[model samples]
Target: MNLSVNVQEEQGTAVVYLAGEVDVYTAPALKETLLPLTEQSSTTVIVNLSDVTYIDSTGLGIFIGALKSSGKAGSKLKITGANVRVKRLFTITGLNEVLDIEEDQREEV
Candidate 1:
């Protein structure tokens, strides 16, 4: 699977777009991508998973780890654009209550 990341900064928020499958082989890269941003400042991080096609346990671990790390650092992490399959994973795993996930709304401010 292919992985692509795009980062945008706005009003102290860091928006990251994740495109592709997140599995054991690629979860490390995703963790690496977020570490620097999380360490830089106490910015609210929004990870957009609209384009993510698949995710494995390792992928889920990275997000959970990031959430803990961000919490300790006094920052917040939000997950957005999770498709039905992904959302089901979160629900089935009881992760939906642990992570902050938002719906996709095209309007921009």
Candidate 2:
């Protein structure tokens, strides 16, 4: 299915909550929502994937682009609450080393 993206502002941070599948079909919506936040100077953009069930390479690419945007804008990008499978994708791609991913205590198989 479809990906649901919601954004909330907390202090100086923009938190984006995502659910459902993040594939090529849904990546554009995510990019639209997330990219602008990353472009804001001195802002912190957090992508919360706690409710997301699936994600593909296209979704990962969006985050990578957001990371780059954040750097150029002097902002911060963080990803949190990723499931085991999703976290493994970042690890395998070696993005975990370059991106700031907060550990999620909940584990899923």
Candidate 3:
């Protein structure tokens, strides 16, 4: 499956909306788009995964890299709208504690 990423800016936050699978083949695209945002000083980068059905280790690595960059650049990284399966991956990897993730109340149909 292909991944689609859409970015938008609201106030001082950079919101990234992702759809489809995030794996080895599509992780590079997310990294390219997200890493740069994380480098911005005093900025907030939010990754929305409401429509993201699957995410692999490679994709999680990209988020880890982005989180590190955000720290050094004095930016903040937030993850939101992750479905149950994706959230479980983070929990299992212990990244759920390291990264700021906001739960959305939307149920997947």
Candidate 4:
């Protein structure tokens, strides 16, 4: 599937659910969706990646930039529900220790 993003609110947090491939061709769109949230003070952004089929190095670069941007703005970005492949990428890049990467227990509604 082509990359798509769905924005929603869960409790007081802003959640962005991503589906399909996130590659050199699609990372820019994800960056746009996240840019505003990154500037918000005390914001908590949740990136739900359960439906994401693939992601390349460029996509990972975007996530890393967002993580740093959010931190500087006093905001937080958590990556949740990444599949085995994506999770392995995080571990391989040593981002698991720097970013809030977690397996989500909540089912999609």
Off by over 4 Å in 2: 107-109
Clashes of 1: 0
Q: Pick the winner on TM-score between candidates 3 and 4.
A: 3
TM-score of 1: 0.89
Q: Can you give the lDDT of residue 84 in candidate 1? A: 76
- Between candidates 1 and 4, the one scoring higher on TM-score is 4
Q: Over the stretch 1-109, how does candidate 4's per-residue lDDT look in tens digits?
A: 4789889966558999999999999999999998787778788999999889789999999898898899889988998998888888999999999999887575533
Q: Assess each prediction's global lDDT (C-alpha) against the native.
A: 0.86, 0.94, 0.95, 0.87
User: lDDT tens digits, residues 1-109, model 1?
Assistant: 8778889989889999999999999898899988667665569999999899888998999988888888778888999988878888888999999899896564433
Instruction: Report RMSD (Å) for each prediction in the order shown.
Output: 3.8, 1.0, 1.2, 3.2
Pairs of residues at least 3 apart in sequence or in different chains that clash in candidate 2: none
lDDT score at residue 50, model 2, on the 0-100 scale: 94
Highest-scoring model, lDDT: 3
> How close is every model to the real structure, measured as TM-score?
0.89, 0.96, 0.96, 0.90
Model 2 per-residue lDDT tens digits across residues 1-109: 9999999997889999999999999999999999999999999998999998888999999999999999999999999999988999999999999999999977555
Q: Model 1 — which ten-residue stretch has the worst lDDT?
A: 100-109
lDDT of 4 at 75: 87
* Candidate 3: residue 50 lDDT (0-100): 91
